[model samples]
Target: MAEDNFEAAPGGFIPGPISSGRGGSGSTARTANSNTLLSEQDVALAAPQADAVPPVIQTLRLQAEATTGVTRGSVSGGTTTTTPVVVSLANASTSDRPNADAADGDAYVDFGGLNGNFNAGSGEYLQWSFAVPAAGTYDLAFGYAFFSASATNRPMRLEVNGKIWDRLFDFTNTGANTTYSEAVTRVYLEAGTQTVRLTATGFSGPNLDYLEIRSADPHRIVIQAEDLLPAATNTTATTVNREITLPFLNGKTPAETFRVGAEGDAYLDWGSEANTLDIPVTATVAGTYSVTITYANGGTTGRPLTLTYLDGTAIGTFALAPTTAPTAYPAFYGDLVPAVRPADGSDAGDVPDQSGWEGWTKSTLTVNVTLNAGTTVLRLSGAGGAQHRQVRVRAGGGVQARAGRPIRHHARQSHGGREPVRRRDRPCHRHRRRFRCAHHRGLRGCEPQHPLRGR
Candidate 1:
């Protein structure tokens, strides 16, 4: 038989021996969750911020004549006889009186809908592309010239990322020799590379001057410890498989830890003396702010630490005071509930209030450190003990990360039951519906001595 090429679809590949509901040589096979969310893998846990600023902005301004970031049609918006030409405001001639930024030789003329009949589907007429610093809503504004001689209720369709913008309006000729940005449209955009397309319709639109894409007022972004991209404790995970992760636990019952996690469902850990955690953080703006490290120290002595190489460069060391209990505190349930036990445990119940767990002698620690825009790290010596759950970074802090966000650190199942079965085995708490490892049932690519797996 000729060999066939096998490939996974955008929805995803569901590998299974079960096949479909039926069986046989000609029987149909089974596929699970066939409706694939192609973009789910790309979605990041947006560190939400308070909508404070009236209209704080990160603007990307593009000059029309600069043809690199744009796609175009055969003609620009104006009269066809005008040659869809590039006008220099320096021209003292009174033909196409350029205004605003245009008055200074910074506008496109005789292009787009010069004759009022724009080719709607051609290259989106004109598009300006720029990278969005972060994902959020933004206002789209433009600088262009308008004149009554070439005007006929000139309607222009503005689009961001191909979607027609509701801010479409007619650039009624403002009697040649004038620029208008009186119309401002708002649209939501995603982070990363994006495009703002302009299409002329219903009439010839104004000659282009410049395109401005400005993000809403600046707000705080929270980088939760739970959202770090999955990986081996020290190395980046390259493939989509069981992450070489440390122990993870979360939730109300059956999985209780007095060490209250960020919000509630994020209780991940790392205590090895020498290991690395590559945290993913997208700071919308570049500025200095107090970064707080949230972790639990169930021990009585301090955990030695060193601050080194954030985002890659080496740095000096800083020590944090040990988080120790003021006095001896007895375990709530006689030390049965891991190092951290619920503050309130009902031993009488079959499951005991796994909802709450804290170390009888444990305490939460918050260390405030200064971090610049990108690149930061925390080094550990593991001298006393190093166990942390989360880290919170913010500037005008008010709200914390909302509870129940997808967690990044995960536990790969172990075939041989050697490690703590309590947190790792609870299937309910580990798998994420959006994106997950198919080998989670029987984790692969893991060594026998993997820190969070086999004994």
Candidate 2:
């Protein structure tokens, strides 16, 4: 689920937004087929609030109904407009623009008084051009339709500023000729004249109702603890042969006996040569980022973990300060139950508090590194016993490192991006899932909370 809630074009919410491509109208009677577009309720529910802090404003929103400085063929009539109209605009060519009618009914009923027509084998498309005031990040929201007998599974390609951003579907045919499905996602943009196009990719292309583009909020990139793939271990087995040293092992508590984050109740291998953890990482954009690593040291002194890039570039080895070090078997309280999936199941919201999360004391260490834009693994070799938490990269303002609470575990994927600035200043978690940036699915802790009431 994306942070931005998708609004149905005119009717109420349509489950999953896809009509069976199998074309089975005979199987069941379609209900409410007359409402082709989203209802007023959906539009109101989907509206993003203006940030009370900074008052976020839309860079551009093009509605097909009225004159908004858009190129139109001005052609009238005909149920389907297959002819391509070439209307030159600021930064795009209307050479492939779709045929349109000013009449309002059926497919055109709620789509701002008019709608662009697309169908199978129609090379035609619809586009709107805008002058980008500045370069940063923006969220592209499309209100569209194509859910009908022929529109099911219609494939459409979204091209922004001449680059194919994605290929999407008009989805399940609603069997209703007038319905439109809406979707919202984030994209990176360089400041300039930008053209956004919804061109036909295959049969029964979708209709374009409206499009909204707004500057994205500042955000961070996080590497979840559990998602890290082990690069190398000190032993094919156990380090320093803790199995053999019965006397030393039996007398002292081992960090492995404790369950932390994802490593529940399993023994953490520790010895001069037994302890080493490595995780693969990649940076999409080259920039200086503040790196923070969280860990729990059961011992009285700080545990030293040497850090280095895959290429052997020393990222500066540092000691994890002693915090919650376990003293005995089952040292920490509470079991490491499965991570709780958030209410939205996207995990793109406030970090949920764990029931028995506080096991051992946890602490953090910080370092700054300007990484090259590509894939590389960071290795951590501890000279003593310690538990590893997740790592994160923060840009612009700083978010305090969470010590005792659980953190969101995002997948191991690198996206080249600069942090997004929030449009409004509201409590983070309140609007936690409100708006997401390019990091939509994979936000800070997967996603940090923020208010986005930009209307």
The number of the candidate with the highest TM-score is 1
lDDT of each: 0.38, 0.38
Off by over 4 Å in 2: 1-56, 65-68, 72-81, 84-119, 167-179, 217-455
lDDT of 2 at 230: 23
Cα error, residue 82 of model 1, in Å, equals: 11
Worst 10 residues of 1 by lDDT: 1-10
Off by over 4 Å in 1: 1-57, 74-84, 89-94, 97-105, 112-124, 149-152, 217-455
lDDT of 2 by residue, 1-455 (tens): 11122211111111111122221121221111111222333322222222212213466667644355444331222223453332212222242122123112212212111143334432345667777665544566765554444333444445567654433322334344344555554444556787876554334344455677765432334333323322123232333212121122322332123233221111233344534444333444445555555444545676676766544567776666665311111111112222312122325644232222222332333666654444334555555545543454444232222321223334445536634443332234643443543434455453433423231
- Residue-pair clash count for candidate 1: 28
Residue-wise C-alpha lDDT for candidate 1, range 205-278, written one tens digit per residue: 56677767765322233333333323223232212111211133222233524343222223334433333443
